[model samples]
Target: MVNAQQYIESSFPKHIYRIFAIGKNLEGHLDLSEYPNLVEVRLGNNPLLTSLSLGPSPRPYLTAIGFRGSGITNFSFLANLPNIHMLVLVNHTQEHQAKIVRDINQVHQCKDQEIEKIKQQIIQLQQQIQSLKTCENSNRNQNSPPNLSSERNNDTS
Candidate 1:
């Protein structure tokens, strides 16, 4: 796996978005920091790899990050990935678990803003429909029963 780093360092691809490494050890994980084009990376079932740093890339396209059964302890490395939206931190202590959830919620306020916009749209539409119904009912009630004089004029026309 270390040799792969030498190969990657020599020639790096610029179009790759997703990378899946199976049965790869911690030695291979070092190359990820060098891959500037990586968006989605899956390095599951690696027993040796514990701590993960997001590294120097802006990580703008990086969204969902999953770490299941990696035996990781410190989650401070996540602070580097500022644009991360959805994160799954499995097999962590209660304190670390709570911190991940809290930090993510603080970073993005989209959930709250979306709910507020929906509420406002609903209220505005409801008021418009109510006004229409009021106008229709008022017109119906004000119109007297069909008069014979109006009926004769309609028949002549």
Candidate 2:
């Protein structure tokens, strides 16, 4: 526990890529600083950690985060982690679980709208490509031997 605080205050060692703080023991320590280089952090089963104090600068690089059985009741800090790809924050009660689901759904809705716009753009491009192919085929038919030869014969007459 003391080493964790020391590492947070001082520059983290180059070898430490991930940190997993579990159990109900790592709470009430007010010196949680930012590990900007830390890739992953797993803090579960910590009943004492009523509120999570996330340090800045570590938000962008964090790829995975898990917080199951923690005492966190609000979903404010999670809204800031943009680089987090995979997260699991399941609680024991239904009300808390519903709040997490609602928050995820709200975020997902915005992403879904963006996805729909991209899909529409892709569809438009495909339609334009198909139209171009049709125009090329029609031009080829007009320049074929049958059409060109008939026109040449008529011109010679």
Give each model's whole-structure lDDT: 0.61, 0.66
- Return the TM-score for candidate 1, rounded to 2 decimals: 0.48
- lDDT winner among the candidates? 2
The global Cα lDDT (0 to 1) of model 2 is 0.66
Task: Please provide, for model 2 over 1-157, each residue's C-alpha lDDT reduced to its tens digit, 9 standing for 90 to 100.
Answer: 3233543445445446676776635454323344556567676777655566566433667677776876666665565466678777766588777887788677667768989999999999999999999999999989876767779899999
Clashes per candidate (backbone, < 3 Å): 0, 0
Model 1 clashing-pair count: 0
Query: Worst lDDT window (10 residues) for model 1?
Result: 1-10
